[model samples]
Target: MFADVRRRPGNYGLGGTFREASAFVNGCDAGNSWGLLIGFREWLALKLGCEANLTWAGLILKLADVDASLHPSGSNLSATEDERAVEVLFAELDEFLSARKGASDVGRILEKYLRQNS
Candidate 1:
């Protein structure tokens, strides 16, 4: 996921990026291709707690201890916010991979890819 974001062309928006990535992964596993997306979504949803929208930006800001108003427009995160977002992304990702269990082969592969690339 991090690698996917990094390989992209321009600025990776927050909540939208995560939502899209999750959807893409889910689509890829439409027929339980890896039996991972559902679990991943569930885990992410759980991590997000009671967010009404459950967006990646919310999770990122929560994890980074940043204020939501910093990006009121939701798309134009400041340079500092962008840096903090990346930091929170890597930190949360590391935590997720370290604590993950019972992951499908595809999930393991994805995690491995992230570990290798990161």
Candidate 2:
């Protein structure tokens, strides 16, 4: 369980399959855990390049939009803008990953995007 893993810091590693690890981590229902998992998959997609499926990218975009929309102080216009941003992010990620770039490359792109937005 996630609690067990948290209690024993050295026990958990990236050794098991992503599904199993993700399920265990999300079982705790902690804030942003699912988003973190989505981030990890995006990282992998960047590494695998064209091998990464579009479905995953779509799901990530959906989650991002949902998160932004659910923000407590977000207005309708802000939500719309966030949704548009998520759409753009998905398009760029799809293009970059389709080019077979590595995680670091994708990370740099993400960093630039985040900085510009902030």
**Model 2: per-residue Cα lDDT over 43-87, one tens digit each:** 434443422344443334434453433432222325454445344
Per-model clash counts, in order, read 1, 0
Candidate lDDT (C-alpha), each = 0.49, 0.42
Tell me the tens digit of each residue's lDDT in model 1 across 76-98: 66666666655665566545655
Q: Where is model 2 more than 4 Å wrong at Cα?
A: 1-19, 28-30, 54-118
What 10-residue stretch in candidate 1 is worst by lDDT?
36-45
Lowest lDDT block of 10, candidate 2: 68-77
Q: CA shift at 33, candidate 1, in angstroms?
A: 6.0
